[model samples]
Target: MTAWLPLESNPDVLTKYIHKLGVSKEWEIFDVVGLEPQMLEWVPQPVKSIILLFPISETYEKHRAQEHEKLSVDPGVFPDDLFYMRQLTSNACGTVALIHSLANSKSISLEDGILKSFLENVKDLTPEERGKALENDKSFTEGHHELAKEGQTVADPEEKVNHHFVALINKNGVLYELDGRKEFPIKHGPTTDETFIQDAAKVCKEFMARDPDELRFTVMALSSV
Candidate 1:
């Protein structure tokens, strides 16, 4: 059996790591808590991306296979500029999703920081290669380690869990789901800058509908201050 690393699913932890990496001062993350319209009313506007936490399951595997088949036949569904990556490590999904949200965001400047340096190093590489590069990135991994320690998540390497994180963002007027586990970015449907939250909420509903009986899922967004 393969060993997987552990990660914190708390949005606060994610926000801490985001700042630690010096992604951008303009960007902020808040827990969605609930997906209802009223709950969303509290979130700041001009949201760049939504991050989801879900438990891995056989049903998710089935959905992934179905989505992969569809994407194989219609690769154009995703925008050409979508930054996607395959999660090379089991526990790295959260990092991958966080990076996906930040790296592809135009509202926030990734100009000169650890993230910018990392992105520059892998800009020309394929998504898979980018994942590998991220796995080996010392600065980024060290930050993740520090945050993990702060979160008290460091544990036996043999421990395993099913939780995972993915990001949803709008690019070229389309809503795309960036899951490192997926072979490519999954384009759900059309969405404009103004309506991305509502559209993304609809997609989140679809995800909820996929496994109606399961309730181990969460949604958070990265928005402007």
Candidate 2:
């Protein structure tokens, strides 16, 4: 398995990488200063998706294992149109999270390029197959490599990265947590386009609550430019 460099949570680098992958300039990634009501109110309207970068601590791992076990037995409802893929390569969670954020966003228009083509080709494939496809895509890999080096602090590809990214998106009026490392998207609860930012913030707070001593969490939103 290939291990690419981990991506920084910086919005400038993320926005540039997405643009290079053919996301229209009309949308861009912005840092979520705070999860409070006043802070969320300052965020640009119509947030397409929310990405949370959190530490993979023992507490989180225990919860994740328990949740996976529970869901494996009783997997709840998720929209058929919800685009998701697993992470087959190491240190690729950032790219996978961005892909989830873009793929599920109906309002964002993708130009004809790597992402557009990849999504079209994998529309009919299963989640594991989609992961393999992304792993073998040289063009996408190259793009990821180039941008991964543009971050503020470049880390070695083989270095251990304790942080992971997951995207929260609203599909068919339900809030789905998309994590490539997970077996399937976790449906949080009911949400609307108008209340997505606030709803996602609540989930983000839960993540923080799990790791109260950790202050490395970063939250970003994909919204209007």
Q: When superposed on Cα atoms, how far off is each prediction in RMSD? A: 2.0, 0.7
Residue lDDT tens for model 2, 1-225: 879889889899999999998999988999999999999998987799999999999999999999999999998867789999999999999999999999998888899999999999999999899999999999899998898888889668989999999999999899999999998899999999999999999999999999999999999999996
Question: What ranges in model 2 sit over 4 Å off?
Answer: none
Q: Which 10 residues in a row give candidate 2 its minimum summed lDDT?
A: 147-156
Residue-level lDDT for 74 in candidate 1: 82
lDDT per residue, candidate 1, 92-137, as tens digits?
Answer: 7878888999888876776567888988898888988998888888
Instruction: Provide the overall lDDT of each model, using Cα atoms, as 2-decimal numbers.
Output: 0.81, 0.94
Candidate 2 deviation (Cα RMSD): 0.7
Model 1 spans with C-alpha error above 4 angstroms:
1-4, 152-156
TM-score of candidate 1 against the unseen true structure? 0.92
TM-score of each: 0.92, 0.98
